[model samples]
Target chain A: MSVLKVAGARKSFDKTQALGGVSLELGAGELLGLLGPNGAGKTTLVRAIAGRVRLDGGTIELFGREITAATNGARAGLGVVPQEIALYPLLTARENLSVWGRLHGVTPGDLAPRITRALDWTALGDRADEPIKRFSGGMKRRLNIACGILHEPRVLLLDEPTVGVDPQSRERIYDMLAELRERGVSLLLTTHQLEEAEAHCQRIVVIDHGKVAAAGTLAELVEATVGAERRVTLTLDRAPDRPLPGFEAGESGVVVRAHVRDVAAEMPGLLGVVRDAGCKVTDVEVRSPSLQSVFIHLTGRELRE
Target chain B: MIPTLLRIAFTTLRRDRVVQMSVFLLPIVFFTIFAAIFRSQTRGVTAGVRAAVVDEDHSEASRRIVAALAEEKGLRVRTAARPEGAPRGAAEVPLDRARALALVKAGDVPVAIVIPAGFGAGFGAFESRAAPIELLSDSSDPVAPQVVSGLLQRIGMTAAPDLFEKLGFSLFERYGGPMTGQQREAMRRWTSSLTDTAPAGPGRAPGRRSAAGDSLSASIVPVRIVDVLGDQKRNPVVALTAAGIAVMFLLFSASSAGGALLDEVESGTLERLLTSRAGMGTILAGKWLYVTLLGVFQVTVMFVWGMAVFQLDLMHHLPGFFIMTFFTAAAAAGFGLVLATLCRTRQQLGGVSTILILSQSAVGGSMFPRFIMSEGLRAIGRFTTFNANALDGYEKVFWREAPLTDLWPQVLVLAILTVVFLAIARALARRWEST
Candidate 1:
């Protein structure tokens, strides 16, 4: 079943268009990634799906139900971990989960085990009772995730939930997503970290300037990468102001280009040709385009810019 | 959904410590300021005034009149050299009717007292029913008229007993009865004292007595000072300040609640709340509920403190006081919501609320007394709800003995003000989420 679908979604704030004609769909048991630079409307799309924002022109559907004007109760099947930590710092992890659960109308009799199970899912069971204020960034992020999913919503939306956490916590979050996938939980995530999306997301949607640039499986995206062609680099003992075939100048050293399917496969022959030019190769490396490379190729600007 | 919204509102209220402290502390702060003002010493009307005694008749009665005016509290008697330029024996130009009026016009003395010619005829007429005493006094200032009137009444009260005694002795003399030895002795004593001690009449040589004994209470009798109104006829300013401070902080509490709204928006707790089955209206309603309750609580605490320390007796007149104060708080909270919604940031809220409070305080009669101001200024004060409901309400409850029924006018004004502000607040709130 489709967990969520957005068709021709548009939203504007003041004079700034935060989301413009964006559309996407997510399936059950899938890890979908919305990738973009800052101000790219990734958070806006997530908020639209979470029902925290109103779409100026479009509709959002969750679990095959038209939820364009869904009341908060109509959204009980959904979970959202917002871009900013929404958990009360003065409240403990357990308390935060209880608040979310109670607000979602979980009965008191069913609350305890639910909280415990949620804690265990996020690896926060040991620290569930500690105040969020006393928690580390990673711990607070984990609690944030736990609070949203405690009621076991069918679809989960996390907006840059791991942005400011340590690498260990990042990996831990990846593992938790995997566990949720095993439990048949559909997840939609927005992140700026391209590699993380490439690693964990089954499908990555690159959004730019408030619209979707690309959406497909990782292999499909990689095959369709904007800087899809690979560049071969030959590092010399010193900066060799030397001529090379199909070469583009780079700041660090000499560079040569080839398609991933073509010249990258002929690296040895290319290296031999360089060798035959009476120059010794200090080091040789083959590089393929990444999602960032794809982004730069599409927008003709650096992702950070 | 309602519970969740209420929880969010209450939680937000509890979380912002600065707003919380202000909301809770405003009433106390105002109470303290007003209490201190009320507890200060009261100054009587006519504490100092210059007057010249012109002795056309040097009768003992005129001297006695001068003596009486000298003994009066708050009158600073200045002896002028002459009634025209200056008096001979008086401290300053002795203020007769015309001179005192001119001095008052020129802003010299608040009031001037003149013992008129034939002044002893009035006293002698009481014994023989022949003539009445006439005194000239400046009545330009409202307070001056009141002071001159009060000083004259005091003299009349003091002289009534002796006049009756002399009249009784005269009556006895006319009856031609075999007078008792004691009665004859009393008549002889009166005659001797009157003949020997009486000044010629009317204006006597100015004496130094009016300066020696007058205390400050004899000044400003018409203007009801806060202190005079508060603790035991506290200085009129004190009572006025207390009432003003109480109402000011009540409005202040409203802004504090408004501030909490900003905190909620900033916290992302509001977002969490909205996404969780709590509609924006539910959240807003809950916030309004909490803030209004807080305002009521703020007023109650202030009144309780006032009653405890200042003996304001909110309980004895509990129904009236509560109804008046509670509605005032509600209206204030409503106005506060408008302030909060219009302001985009907490800092903006701070600036806006301060402006609101100061403006209201100035026009609402908190910072100063409005009665002494001109009719136009007083009319300008009535434009603000704080003045319309507050002064009228306080006057009805604190100064006058009135029941809850009397507070309906104030209540209606405040209620209407509350509704208008709340409507404005609601309209503003819809745009606030985006801001």
Candidate 2:
């Protein structure tokens, strides 16, 4: 069963249409990634699901219950971690969680345990009492996510949750999200980090200009956009005088490059052809189609753009 | 480097509307308000005092006294009438002593004059028994009563000669039988010349100028001005300044607290809150409560300090003071929230709030006393949330010792303003939900 369903979500701000007939679904325990360039309606779509933005026209359902508007009861089962660090800098990590937890309708009797569990999950247990201003960027990011998940909502929507964290914090955040997925919590996250999405998300949706551009597994997206091509590069000891089919020389003229439909099937023949042409192969490298290449190919721009 | 720094500064100032307004507009507005006040003070245009006259004696002497009071430029005299069974459109009816005293106590009129029965007949008669004319004043209105008292004293000086001639004839009739036409003429001439002449050198008795000079000045008995309300001596300037500064900072604190909404928006906390079970109303209400409480606390601290350092009478006027403080804070908070909702950015809010709050303070008498402002400016001040109402309410409580009922007008205005501003803020906050 779909844990969260959005259909024909439409919203406009003045003359700019932020969301135009956008639709998506998250299955039970699914980890879905949303990718878009700047001003491409990704945040708008997430906000609509979180009930922060009122849609001009659309329907949103959580666990088969249709949400017609952004009301408190409609958003009761949802959790959202916004792009910016939304925790109060003057408040301690525990205090921030308690405030947000109460706001989310967690009973005071139940709030303490949930706060403790959330703090433990985010690995901020030791620093729970410390003010967020004194925390490292990674710690604050963990606390930010912790604040949203204290109520254990059925669906969680995160917007660039780990924008400027160190590598260690990023990995920790990925691990925490993985654990949440294991616990049967559905997740939809928007991020500019293509590698993170590619590494963790079960499926990905690319949105551009208020509409879904593509939605599928990584391989499916790769096949649809860049056609499963593998980029192969072979560093040579000497330049080859003769040219090979569908291959080009690198800037130094010693590196030979080719885009192969199947790297495993073409590497031996390509190496033999280069050897026959009087070039000595010093190094060989092969790269499979990645989300970055697929994203660029589909959106025709960088994520930051 | 110098040129580079200068360019950067100018660019920043030009780019930021808030900075531009604070730097360019605030001083000009303050200067205008204060200059107008100073000019008014130097020109010495005393504000008119509202008073009522109750003539129990319908004689010519009583009528003359009433006419003299009506003619004073600074006094606005209204005849107090018995409201019982009087026609709705009746221009005048006699007010008894009890009714006149009631008017003074109720603060309907700051001062009430009562001409006792037989006062007119007894005028200038050395032996006739008559009660002294009474000037009943509301102690709560310290300043207006003083003005009324001064006007009465001046009226006495003008009526001295007539009183002296009457006294001379009465004494002559008692001692030497009825005076002939020539004797009466001589007495009138002597009394007129005696009043006209300057006192013969210093230290000579003012009454020694003529045989009846003492009796003459003594015949026009000084009006007995009595303060019906409690006499709590207070410095009006100190009270006004305390209230003004308190109100000014209350607006500032409220606006600062209201600006927290923009901060939350920029920080994304508002979006997170919206995504929670709390609705937009809940969020705005929470902010409103915080700002209101902040203003109350701010004003309390200021007044407490004022009491400690400046001897402000906070303890005696606690009830009126608190009522004014609460309403002022509530209105200020509402104003702040409306301001925040109207602007899209913190910079925009800052520019708008600075222009609005400072202008209101200047025109409303938060920076200067409204008494010194021109009628037009005073009218404008009256419309401001603080000056002609909130601050005025505070001054009345602290300096005038006004009762709760007496402060109802100011309280009503502030309460209405608070409701209106809150409604506007609520409507404007819908923009956030739509975003």
Candidate 3:
């Protein structure tokens, strides 16, 4: 059964609309990546789900119960790692985890092991005693994630979880999320990290200007966005003035875009054409579609812009 | 639950050197400034007297009397070579009656006293007449002149016993009769009998007005001050300092509450807390609890320091103090919360909180003591929460030493204010999220 459902969610701040009629269904163990540009209402959707903000016009159901406004029970089911760090700078990581546990009504005996496990999962056991103020930005981000998970809620909402984190820390975080997803913790994460989403998310939804422009698995969305055929690129030293059919000259006469039946079927022919063009033929490469390219094609703007 | 918040607040206070200095150390600095300002009155009101002694009589008695006036503590003596050349009247003497009046206009000395040329002849003639030396005093300066006049009067009145005995002995020697030691003792006793009618009149001399003031200034006789704010007869500085502290705490309470607002909003905990099991009222209650305790702690520290320095009678004034402190703390807390709620970020809170606190403290008599402020300014001060019940309470308890029953007026007003603020705060409460 679908445990959490958000249907036709719309939210606004002042006159600026943040979300418009966005819908999602989370079944057990579903790890969904809510992808969008910087101003794509990703944070807003997360906040709305966590009950930190009231949706302008929408219905949100969690665990088969409708949660129109946030209540302690509804909130108890949600675990959010906010974009901004929320742990007290003056508090040690262990104390920070303890506070969150207590806030969720965890018992001290149960709390210690749970905190230790959360820290261990984040590979932060050695740094648990240090105050967050003493931690590097990457460490703080990990601690921030540890805090959100300490409550062990059924539905986890992460907003840009790997933002501003070092590569090592980012991988550690990705591994932890993978483990949680495998363990049947349903997840809804908002991220601009397209690669991470592409690799980890079971399904993807792209939101733009408060509306869901597209939703599906990466392959489905990519197929839906572009034609079945792939585009191949051939590097040349100079552009041939002679007519090269179905060829578009790219930057500095070095890159060229051409339609192809199959990347493998076209690479040899494309290289021969480049050699015949008398352009200093260089390497040949197949251009596979990325979420970034899909987004740019769909929105006509950069993901961040 | 409460202890956790306290630990957070104090830990933040300890960790933040900026807040520590602003809240705690700044007050000590202001206290030192205030102490120094009041300490200026520690010296007698010594106005310079610009006058010439005629020395026409050339008698030992004339020289003796002239020498006495010259050496007078309140008179900063300047001598003119000749009596005729001496500044003709009060205004010419550096700090004489007319000179003091001009000084009041010119903003120089607030007081002056002139000893006339014939003062010795008059003192010698006191056996036949009631009056002795003529004391021309400048009364333009309200406080200083009265002080100078009183000092001079007491000086002569206290010396009357010896003068009377000397005159009596001179009179008795006109018959050329040999006198025994018994006769001298009898004359001394006879002269002492007129001590009751000495100068400065009726009861005790004006110089001995307050025992606490005696050690500081021998000439300054501290008296009941009729306040410009409410026409209440009280000690000016005592009322002012209490008002200052009261106003200052309003700023502190507001700032403290405002900081909490920023932290919650910034950390996104405010929405989480509201959405949790904790009701809006509970959230507000928790915040108010923290703010009130902070305010009470601040006030207690200040009062303890004040008592250590000024020996304030906090024991007797405890009940009235509690009544005043409670409402003051509550009002400031409400004000601060409103400012915080209106601001989106911590930086905004910082800017707006400063403007509100400083402006209120200025009008409410914190920046400068209310006692020194003008009438219209005092009226403006009355509208502010700091000046409202705080000044009244300080005047009643510290200055006038009124009974608790007599302070019911201030207590009632403060309670009403606390309620008004609380109502406004409750009305403005919105169950909102940041998305």
Best by DockQ: 2
Q: Which segments of candidate 1 are over 4 A away from where they belong? A: A12-18, A69-73, A89-95, A107-109, A119-131, A227-286, A302-305, B1-243, B307-315, B369-379, B394-401, B433-435
RMSD versus native structure for model 1: 14.3
Please give the lDDT score at residue A68 for candidate 2.
56
Give per-residue lDDT, candidate 3, residue B366: 68
Tell me the whole-model lDDT of each prediction, alpha carbons only: 0.67, 0.79, 0.64
**Tens-digit per-residue lDDT, A95-214, candidate 2:** 999999998889999999999899889888898898889999999998899888888887999999889999999999999999988988899999999999999999999998899999
User: Which prediction has more favorable lDDT, 1 or 2?
Assistant: 2
Model 3, backbone clash pairs (residues 3+ apart or across chains), number: 6
- Which residue segments of model 2 deviate by more than 4 Å? A70-72, A244-246, A301-305, B1-16, B23-46, B54-63, B82-92, B95-102, B112-154, B157-244, B299-324, B362-387, B391-411
Deviation from native of the Cα of residue B286 in model 1, angstroms = 1.4
lDDT, model 3, position B117: 46
Which of candidates 1 and 3 reaches a greater DockQ?
1
True contacts kept of 3: 0.39
Cα lDDT, model 3, residue A290: 82
lDDT by residue (B1-435, candidate 3, tens digit) is 999999999998888655665677656655654454344445432223332233444444444444554666545444332222256462432233343333333222333334444444444233433222223222222454454444444444343434635655776787677678898788767766654454322234445533323442332212121112222332235544755765576666666665676797678666555534566667776777678767766776776666677665566677767766766676667666776666666665665565556555665656665433333445656775455456666656654555678677766766677666656655566634433
Runs in model 3 lying further than 4 Å from the true structure: A12-16, A70-72, A107-109, A231-284, A302-305, B1-243, B267-280, B313-323, B343-359, B362-380, B394-408, B429-435
Per-model i-RMS: 2.8, 1.4, 3.1
Q: Judge candidate 2 against the unseen true structure and give its global Cα lDDT, from 0 to 1.
A: 0.79
lDDT of 1 at A224: 71
- Which residue pairs does candidate 2 place in steric collision? none
Q: Please, what is the TM-score per model?
A: 0.66, 0.84, 0.63
Which 10-residue span in candidate 2 chain B carries the lowest summed lDDT?
B198-207
